[model samples]
Target: MFMCRGDVDSQLCHECIGNATQHLSSECSLSKQASIWYNECTVRYSNDSFFSVVDMMPGFYMCNTANFSNTKSFTPLLFSTMNLTADEAASDKKKFATNERVFEFQTLYCLAQCTSDLSSKVCGTCLRSAIKQLQIHCDGKLGGRFLYPSCNVRYELYPFYRSINVPSPNELAPQTKDSISKQDSRFLEDPFYLSYNCSSNHNTITSKNFNLLLSYLVSNATAGKLYHRVIMDEIVYGLFMCRGDLPSRLCVQCVTNAKDRIFSMCLSSSEGIIWYSHCLLRYSSQYFFPNIAETSPMYRDINITNHFISDQNLFTSTLSNQLSELANATGNSDERYMINSLKLNDIQTLYTLEQCTPYLSPQECISCLNDMISTQIPWSFLGSVGGRIIYPNCNMRFELFQFYIESDEARSSRNPSKEAGELFAQIGFILFL
Candidate 1:
């Protein structure tokens, strides 16, 4: 596989890739695996295929010799900037992103890129692991970069690449090795993949049957089914559940994107799960419908770089109480999903969303959520502007902004004070005193 830094022009990207490949082949002729990183690109070859999988071995690191004097403030700014860049790269179809932040008087330029073959979740995870390397080896440095086979991260005190002229819709077409195919550039622009898990064991028959089931699920999604499951013999089962609030069009788009990426994302693992912001899709060798899913592969994310609560104790208790209400509401609702907004103050409004695999029994749904709330919440970041714990069975998220589209009823009751009052009436909630 080959990848170029996001800012490199197409002609430059091609030239660098060609040079790296020539040098690596001659220098490591006898080796089974070899990789070369140039200033603008990376070229890698392995005896076994490694597309879409995150790999950290055989890595390299570089940093500026100088150190920053303002480590205290720069630390947080660095974390915030890199994280923002990583999120954008992971969500983009090109699997590339850049960011610029002004900290005090100095400007920080950041870039993150993943191999095009990686799913957004895997890409984000890969970049994050690479980011950790910065802290370990290059702490207090003015600039640094981590280079790996699957992804690379770089940050500097000055601009190191092309100008980040914001691209319009027409310019988004993939035109180089550094971009995704034109077919992928559509539909996938919006649904941000969150996480994924897959079993290593692969079965030929199971994979074949699972593909058929996936087609079925996609068909149902096109037909506007909010949730659907199929048992394709005793060896393969598949299902998909769109977030309750999304329109049928977005649901179909996210489900289709998942189908296209799941096999490659899992490295052809027969049983796999992929989560996008708009939908969740999973398939397994054993039937798992109507059962409380094991939370072994749960994922959590926190917006630590964003705003944090001023009153930690009060916000903690309030958030806990709000999530509990959402859990209860989701468990008992027909859709197995709930969204709520609680006004913390004029400047801060806490929005929460909770959902389960629709087929689960109400009790099972609540149990799954309660378990996550008690054991998995990122308490250290609980006072941050946003955070979430996601399990295969259920997931709960809390952010300072509303992340979902409001329904007709919510629009009708848009009065701020009335909405706050109705929150208590509907969920039997009490004001945080």
Candidate 2:
């Protein structure tokens, strides 16, 4: 049987399931029994039936490297909260519970859940065991989680839960992934060919209004307003998005630099898009946020060292599929970004990334990614080892080697000067920010 983390939002649960199934099928191809955990979901299957059985073997635990400010008081409170949540979860038919405790400086959140198949007695036992494991393995940490096959427990000082603000569109109106897919043709127009008839109504704005707009870009965009709109005779719609994986400080700096550069480059034009090393900024006199996924007012950049490959078709096909999967995952993920690695052959690996501005709806993100895949990227970058395609709403890239920063070391390696140099180098070439 397959069971994912049941405490997450239902859509995230399904997305995690998809990731686990795909990964397990690929990574554990020959195994008769396998279990895996993604950040938001878990999946396990075995040849023999194990329903309602408490399987604790092969469990794992992780803790935040950072410790709380006041552990003497915090430790007791954390355990008390955990025990309360665990007992409630064990008794509940759904086998899940959440609790929060207000501390002097911050609030602590805890969650506990057991597989629905487990009986109340067995669930209680499993949760108690998980609590012990957490104590032994992650004591004194600010955040941590322990996972067993039957139950899982987690606590954190941060709001790790999904925000109620982004209400599930399904709750508002019945919509399934299939229904979203069915609307593809309507949103994902042809990539190779597109037609646009622009109006000549370029309503000129005063210098004062333009300066105000630029101020808004620097203030709001640098402060993390990924989407903003200002309307006059001609509406000024703006979007600035940093790479989803970047640290907050770097994201702020990247957007700030781009805002300054865009004023110099595109101040005269009412519609313009600019790309930086860590961010992308675009503004227009036209409103184009929620529906810009289908359009292709975009660009691309390929690595100069495009090594030749013997099997171009295989490479292209593999890359396309990977990018598509990443697109789907990113749209569904809370962060609107995903990283995946694919083995092109014995010697080479393809690292791929897909990201969308968090402001876009999940469906729009999917459409934007599909539109990129349908573009001439496959043909244009067929033999190239690495390349990126960028649009305003979303972007994707692939390389034979890992080019993205996935760790603290990678993020810290770049100083502000290096960031500026990289951005300048790509100004006329491909902007990969």
Candidate 3:
């Protein structure tokens, strides 16, 4: 068996593969055949013949078992998403792809993979077979996975693969210079807007929010920020956030550029959010809190074990309680999440994190958090815990392990100007008292 990182970039693939080869041999000493998979790559070697030729003998097919309401519509959408993703993977040297398609407002996440060694035709064939196997096993279910010797495909209601790099839709769509200028003019005229009436005179902006938004924007806008512009309207407000790890100037530039791009795309819509692994973009005409909305659309790669938790009830209760506490504590605070580990038994630990946006009221945060926990706890998420609840004003996410950067580093990297703004607000409040 062989397992490689789903997000391995072309430059680092060979290095990861080499590391996996060495590690697998040492870790599985008694077993002549073993496979180790990473988020960035995979490696496996078996004493038995398991290369070049596709092997379906020891494969598994699992699905949600609940059939789609409209098979005809779902089937075509599924096929299209698969085809698009395959074309992308085939063209790219990494041998991986991630894509999402919508059916009746439901998002379907699909990931396809072929061994780096396979020819395009062979890769296509292997993926097709793997997909067919999923249909046989999962039938009408909302999610399924098919794994074979040479290739694999997985489809789920939520994203599974992490950090797939693909060209944006705007890149593929043709636009003349005149059209581009017109679009830019329209975007600048009426950009996304949000209204946050200051509840108190002492209320001030925090560097944390600016930092989060800036880092998120930079990661998405790798080209540069000078080409982009920020547009604020009366009815709707737009804020683009990049990953927190980026350089300060780069983060600002990324956010600026993304705001321009987002304005161009969503100028007509009243509410929308588009997020990349590195940045998050949000715009809303109405206050959207304590209300369920899918504004910020983002994806991450997650590798769940095939094994199920030994004690389902205990795990569920523990996770739920932790989430509730986090929600209550994170209200209107820059540090909105917490991650820690608990020893389950001698060999296993339940590592978890609970996070919410800093803008939400405590009650609003808890309600939103509970809704997310309810959806994920009931599902058999490959023995892994993962879920994301997107709202207009705030969002909440939790997993069994640490998937995001720690809060300390995130806080330290805030904009100095924004930090001063927060400090000023605090001082004003003390003076008022």
Question: Where is model 2 more than 4 Å wrong at Cα?
Answer: 1-203, 224-235, 303-312, 343-347, 408-433
lDDT of 3 by residue, 1-433 (tens): 4446465445445655665666655567677655554333545566777666655444555454345678877887887787787777666576778887656644677888888777777777778777777767776666666665566787765444433333321122111232112222221222222211112222122333323433444454555431222333333334554443344465555455555565555444555565432345664554443333232333322233455323223343334444443444443344444444444344444444444454455445544544444333332332334444444333444443344444455545432212210111110000000
TM-score quality measure for candidate 1: 0.51
Q: Where does candidate 1 stray beyond 4 Å?
A: 1-189, 204-207, 303-312, 380-383, 409-418, 424-433
lDDT, model 1, position 165: 58
Of models 1 and 2, which has the larger TM-score?
1
Q: TM per model?
A: 0.51, 0.45, 0.37
Report the Cα lDDT for candidate 2. Answer: 0.61
Show pairs that collide, candidate 2: 277-433
- lDDT of model 1, residue 296: 64
**Highest TM-score against the true fold, candidate:** 1
- TM-score, candidate 2, is 0.45
Which candidate leads in lDDT?
A: 1
Whichever of 1 and 3 has more TM-score, that candidate is 1
CA-lDDT, candidates in order: 0.69, 0.61, 0.48
- Sorted by TM-score (best first), the order is 1, 2, 3
- Per-residue lDDT of candidate 1, residues 224-288 (tens digit): 98788887765677888887777788999999989888866764676788988778888887667
Preferred candidate (lDDT higher): 2 or 3: 2
